[model samples]
Each structure stands twice: as structure tokens, then as C-alpha cells.
Target: MVCMKDPTVQTICEIYEKLSKLDNLSPSKNVDTLFTQLVNTCIPPYPIDVTKLCTQIQIIRTKLIRLCGHAEGLLEKHYSTILGSFDTPLDHLYIFPYYSNYLKLARLEFDLLTQHCQNPTRFAFIGSGPLPLTSIVLASNHLTSATFHNYDIDGSANSMATKLVQSDTDLSNRMVFHTNDIMNVPGSVLKDYDVVFLAALVGMEIEEKMNVVEHLAENMAPGAILMLRSAHGARAFLYPVVEPRDLRGFEVLSVYHPTDEVINSVVIARKCPIPTVSSIDHQGFVTQMTCSKCAEIQVFNHQIEELAMEEHIC
Candidate 1:
């Protein structure tokens, strides 16, 4: 106002305000253009760290692209269902950015795990999506692993992960990729790992998630660490895609708020030793096992026969 607010300064300030409000944009055809403009204007000055700034912008752009892709894929895949018929653009946007939080939690978990690793340890990653890659990067940076096995149902995901890890010489020696259904992973096939990572796996349906957790619990060796990152809240307020169950045997190690809307919780549960039937008293309880171990009775039941066979053969 004093000097017409200096036109360039006014323009920059206007763009900054628009970018700040981009999160509030309603569903409209013009929203995309609004985001594009925001992205354009967020570019830093010429002397700034251009590579870092560009990477940040690309991350935001990638999030948007991934959201659109997921929405389109869901529509195509579930065309017969009511959800498939509904346009869920906002849902995609909401969940896509949550991965940024997931990445933050993953780094924390990786640091915690690395501090505890005394020997060469294998880390198995289930649902080897972007979050797992974040963990992989942390692991590589810290030189924490004996090796890494990344498993995903999507062949393309496996391929991408393999390519990414292989491109890094330090990570290349430590990472292997497996393209297969997580449900089909044999308990024996999973037993050697020291740590099992379940990132983004809980975002699946309840039954499927339980199945995956059950499988991980069964396959992991006693004393092995199972690290899980998932969206959590009471049922009503929680994300509806994946149902949250009681954490059960897992111990909540840390809960981090990486963003305003998203809370990333890291749970580290030691794979409790499955007590043999002979080890139980007449009441079918192991007197020495803790209350947490008692709660794991059902998980033990589902796994005992298979684990017994595995131990015998070994």
C-alpha cells in the first residue's frame, strides 16, 4: 500500500497464502490447477539448493500422482461394488500423504532396531512399498543389516524395489526381492529373519491384515522383532480401509506425530516362544509365561503344529 506493496512481494505473498490454503480446496475441476499453481510458486530462489528443492517438489507431485493412480485403480478393480462407483478423490489424497508420516515413523523404528542389533541380522519387509524403501534407505545408511528380503504381491513393486536397492552399491549387497503373495510365505521361509517389518500391510482389510499378522507371528523366531506401523484411532474416527484390532502381544514402543492429521505408531513385539503342550500344567497354561504370553495363546495354537514340524526337521 505504501508503495503498492511492491508488486513482486505482493505476488509472492499471495502465492504463499494460496499454497497454505491448498489443503482446504473443495472438490472442483479447478482444484488441480490450483495445486499446479501452488507447486509452481513454491519454487525457491536461484541461489537456493535447487536439487533439494526440486526433490521436495517432486515428492509432493509424486504423492498427488500416486493418489490419482490408486483411485483410478480402485475404480477399475471394484467396478461392481458401491465404493468402485463412488469417486473417492479426497480419500486418495488423504491416505497418500499419510505415507510421508509412515516414512518418518519408519526411520524412528529403524534407528531403534539398529541400536539393538548386536550381530548381522536379516530384515524381512512385507508389503515392500514406499515405506519399506524408506526403511531400506535407513538400514543402508546405518550399515545395520546382514541382508534384506523385500516381498510384495505386486511384481512391479518388487521390480521397482529391486532396482532401487540395486542402484545403490551399499544397499545392493544386502537386498533381495521376492514377488509373491504374502499369505503364501511359508513359516519356514520366514523363520530366519531377525526383524520382520510390516509397513502399510495393516491398511488392507481386517481379515487379510489379521491373516498377515498371524502369519508373521507364526513364522518369526522366538526373540525376533516384529515392527508394525499402522494408522490407529478408535473405530469411529479411524481410517475405514483397515480395521484396528487390539495390539495384542505387541508392545507400543513409540508414537510419533509427523503431521497434523497422521499419527505414526511403532510397535515392537518379540515373537514369544511357543510353549510345548508338555510345558503346560493341567490347566493348559505355562505358569512361567507372562500375561502377554497368555494372551498369545491363540496365536500360538495357530502356529504350533507348523513350528513344531519346522523345529523337528531342523
Candidate 2:
């Protein structure tokens, strides 16, 4: 078994220690055993000290991301195993979902984005790992007019995702895959995309993120939406989530937290009439939006579904 020492780290810390040493980066009986334990431990956003739990989650996730690189493409390999075992992708999808339950976890985010963006026809999914569940959902759901483009840095993943799409002939036609590092992806390609999805687990550092933001700020067509998956509470432990500050180039339209679901949050942003020094006028402007009734923009509010009603911004 893999071994590491951490007095305060607890379960995930121990799991990380074991996982880091997986024989040749392949999942063995030990890996499956540990995965079972992990699923039970992390699911069910329990009513406990979430801050501590989330921190542990993030640490384990970050470590997995780092270790996956050396594991001979083993990170997403296990997911393939799981998918193959399923009778139909949708059979246990809502339950088992992706390895990290990313789609199920981010269900709230997707639901919220769909509600607000209504008829987005052009979509780009960045860092769509081997599974490409997000792209699959978008294509399958919006077959009428939506076009989904997927970009990934991993050549193997890009290839696998392409095949997965082709496996569903209908989906294949609507979705296009590209193997390109997010930092290297051309701004012109994303120029007309109505919506761009930046996965939370996207393996990118601060510098790369900055490069992407700057590129998008310069390239994405005006009025395009950037759907950023953000981590919150314990879900933040899963991946490097986005912060409002990271998206200075775009305007924050809304943030939605799917209650009783994943700990991650979603932020809907719009690139339009790029914020200028003048946008921040005297009465302490409300970042991207303005008060419809009065000048005082006191606080940020929840999304409509979350609050069961629309908020009056005044």
C-alpha cells in the first residue's frame, strides 16, 4: 500500500499517500478499494464543519491531478472502466456520473446556466477531459441548433473524447473536438462562441489562467458568456475554482449555488462593452450591473431558482 505521513490530514491525506504510489500509475485492487472508501467519504455534503472537510477535499484533488500526469494516462483510465461497465451512459450517470461526479456535482451549474442563457447556439468547452460529459450533455440536449466545441491539452483525452462523440453518431455531428492547450488555443476560434465553459479541474496554473483570461478578453466576441465553475464550501477542495477577481475581463452577471448538491458554484459572465474606468462611477458601482431603482447596490443576491424568485437590484 502507498504510504505517507500526516498527523492532521486524516483519511484523504492517507488516501493521497496510497494513491501517489499506485503501481506504475495503474489502478489495482488497492486503487478500487480506496476509491470505494473515497466515494463513501466525500459524497453527501454532510452537515459538519464543511470548511475543514472542503480543505481536505481540495488537497486530495490537487494531489490526484499532479499524480495523474505521471500515471501513464491512468487518471481517466478508471473512468473508462466505469463507463464500460454501465449498461447505458445514463443508467447510473446521475448517481455514479464522472469519476469525481463532476457532471452530477455541477448539475446545479448547468441547470442554472441553461435557465438564464436560454438559446445559446455556440458553445466551447475547455479542458473537457477524456469523458467529455459536459460536451455530451450540451450536444444531446440542444441538437436543434447548438454547436459544441471541446478543447483539451491531453492528446489521448482529445482522441478518446472524439471517439466517444462518434460513438453517438448524432452527437458527433454537433460536437467538434480539438487538442490544444488552453494557453495556446486561438482567441479567434472562441471569437463567436456564445458560451465558453472552463472546467474547474482544468490543470492550469495562475499564469496560464491569466493568459487565458487575457486571450478571451481580447478575442471572444462581445456579449459572449463565460460560464466559470467555482468551488465553494467543501467542493472547493475538488479543484482550483474561479474567483470573481480572476475574471476582471468579463462582467459577472450572476452566481448560482445548487442547494443540496455539489459544493461547487457557477458564475455566469458576459464579455460586453468591456468595463472601463468610467464604468466605476462615483456612487460605488455594482461591478458589472447597476441598481434599477436606486443608486445603492448593497449586496449580491442568489439566483432566481435558488431564491424561488427574481431579485430586485436596487
Output the number of the TM-score-best candidate: 2
Q: Write the per-residue lDDT of candidate 2 for residues 17-124, one digit (tens) a residue.
A: 777766665656776576555544544443333234455455566665455333424645556546645545433444433434464534445555665577888888
Q: Pick the candidate with the highest lDDT.
A: 2
Worst 10 residues of 2 by lDDT: 290-299
Candidate 1: tens digits of C-alpha lDDT, residues 17-105: 45445543433445546544533333222122212324434343334433433432332223213222224321232233234544444
The alpha-carbon deviation from the true structure for residue 116 of candidate 1, after best TM-score superposition, in angstroms, is: 5.5
For candidate 1, the TM-score is 0.53
Q: How many backbone clashes does candidate 2 have?
A: 1
